[model samples]
Target: MAISSAVQGVSTAKRQRFLRSTVVLHAAAAVTGLVMVLYLLAHMYGNYKVFSGQVAFDGYSHYLRTMGEPLLPRTGALWIIRVVLLASVLIHMYAVIALWRRMRKATAGKGGRRYQSRKNPRGVQRTYSSFTMRWGGIIIFLFVIYHILHLTVNAIAPGGASESPYERVVNGFSIWWVVATYVIAMLALGFHLRHGFWSALASLGANTSPARRRLFNQTATVLAVVITVGFLIPPVAILFRGVGS
Candidate 1:
């Protein structure tokens, strides 16, 4: 009996440590997700400058690269931002994957199926945004790599390669398939952001009341719509209206 008690105590202690680590991962994911959201807003604003014409758009790109001249070398500030964003992306992905694995493990049983709730006909209380979160994240991840290659790196231009960022935007989006791909990716991002924003806030302990929950939900929806629309406009305009042409 004494040996069994000691073994049980050790198990309990291990469970406590596991729970604490999970909490830390949640916090890390929340913080990093928020950081990326801020970056997205800024990036969306920069993208809007494309409507100002090629010179203005390319100038904006140059401004980003030379942001901290004198105080820092050319592209130094940009590199700093890149490093921060990369670190945030890595940490956020790691935390999310770890938490997801824990959730799957906890739910693993009864033929490795998730729990069925009688309260909901679908077996789980899941919003469309939440339900699509994992797949949407995958789409967004793949699109980001393609976006960097097409525009930033000038390595995989769909229409044609160009030194000018403005030309890259106009050239790429001018293609029908390219625009379609972008639209699909943006829609996925919208869904991801809708759920992720609210989830991140909740993870950070912001969903304290029903009122706060409603507000966060509304805010998440608005942000998702705005960011999605904001990104889509330039590409759609370039494709159909010849905004850059």
Candidate 2:
């Protein structure tokens, strides 16, 4: 009996440590997600400058590379932002993947039954946004790589290669298939952001009351709409409206 008690106590301690680590990972993922959201907002703003014309757009792009001159080398500030974003992406992905594995393991242990919520009449706590979260993330990941290669690296230009950032925007979006791919990716991003924003806030302990929950839901919806629309406008306008032309 004493040996059994010792083993049980050890198991309980290990479970407690695992739970604590899971919580930490949740917080880390939430914080990193918020960081990426901020970056997206900033990037969306930059994308809007394309409507100001090629010179203004290219100038803004140059400013990004030359930001903090005298205080830092050319592209130094940009590199700093890039490094921070990369670290955030890595940490966020690691935390999310780790939690997801644990969730899958727990579900398997429970005979593959998903936890049900009282709020859900279907006996499942799933939302459309949550349902598509993993797949949407995969789509977004692929889009990001293609986006970087097409625009940033100038290695996989759809229409043609160009040194001008504004030209790149106009050329790439001018292609029908490119625009379609972008639209699909943006829609996926909207769904991802809608759920991710609320989840992040909840993970950070912000969903305290029903009222707060409603507000967070609305905020998440608005943020997702704004970011998704904001990003889509530049490409759509450049393609159909001939804004850059």
Candidate 3:
């Protein structure tokens, strides 16, 4: 009796610790995701500069590299931003893995088989989002790598990347498949953002009231659409040769 009681006590304590850890991790991931969303919005606006002509667009790129002027070295501010974003990505991934493990353990602990069919609206939304998220994340991740390779490094340029950043963008989008892939990736990003933004707010405890929940949902939807359209415009315009002189 004493041995079993002691074991139970220890297990209970461990469970409590796990719950607290999960909460903290979820909150951290939510905050990091929010930061990334803000960055995406700013990046989308910068991308829109392509419509102003090559000089304006390339000047914007140069400004990013020399942001802080004499107070910071060349690319110093950009590097700082990169490091912060990298840290956020690591933390967010760790939190995701931890929460997933915890959820699996919980399901197994209930003595249920792998397949149980329960149909509820919220549950269905969750199921759909979870299914889409894994693949959507992979797509977005690959797109990011390809985007950096195509534009930033000028390594795989189809029409050649000259000294001008504007030329690289135009050259890349000039390819039919490139624009198609970009559009597809942006669609995936839109889906991911639609679910992720709302969930992040929920994780941060911002949906306590019905009014707040409504506002959060609306904001998330608006943001997702805005970002998707904002990013798609420049690529589509470049592909069609519809923008700039």
Candidate 4:
């Protein structure tokens, strides 16, 4: 009997350790995801410069490269930001996988909904944002890779790797297929952000008060819409405005 009790105690301790680690991972992912959201807002702002004219847009791109010039070499600040974002992405993905595994383990024998919120007494149905999160994330991730290749590296430039940032953007959006792809990707991004932003706030302990919770949800919705429209405007404008004339 004593030996059996000891084994049970050890198992409980192991479970506790696992739970603690999962909590830490969840917190880290929430924080990093919020950072990425802020970065996207800044990126969208930069994209809006396209409306000002080719010279303004190109100058904005150039300014990003020389942001911390002299004290830091050209593109130094940009590389630093890239490194930070890359690390955040890796960490965020790791945390997501770990939490997902834990969730699966917990629900192994429970054959009901895999993602229902048990905290709600009414047993409310999941929102579209939550329902589409995983697939939306996949779509956005694939889109980002294609976007970087198409614009950043010129691996698939429409007009043969133009030197002008404005030209590359205009050239890419000139294609109907590219504009269509961008619209789909932006829609996915909007849905992802809608859920992700509010969830991040909850994870960070901002949902304690009813008012705070409502504000967080509203802010998340606004952010999702603003970013989605801001990003879509450039490509849509270029497509309809005639790329060079």
Residue pairs that clash (backbone atoms under 3 angstroms), model 3: none
lDDT of 3 by residue, 3-110 (tens): 999999999999878756978888987998888898898899899889888999999999999999799999999999989887887887788767767777988844
Cα TM-score of candidate 1: 0.88
Worst ten in a row by lDDT for model 2: 109-118
- Tens-place lDDT per residue, model 2, 82-191, is 99999999999999988888888988844234566777655566679988988999999999999999889989988888999989989889988999999999999999
lDDT of 1 at 135: 89
TM-score-superior candidate, 2 or 4: 2
Candidate 4 C-alpha lDDT tens digits along 13-60: 998787569678878889999889989988988887877788998999
Residue range with the least summed lDDT across 10 consecutive positions in model 4:
109-118
- Cα lDDT over the full model 1: 0.91
- What is each predicted model's overall lDDT from 0 to 1? 0.91, 0.92, 0.84, 0.86
Alpha-carbon runs more than 4 Å astray in model 3: 1-20, 109-127
Of 2 and 3, the candidate ranking higher by TM-score: 2
Badly placed stretches (over 4 Å) of model 1 are 1-20, 109-119
lDDT of 4: 0.86
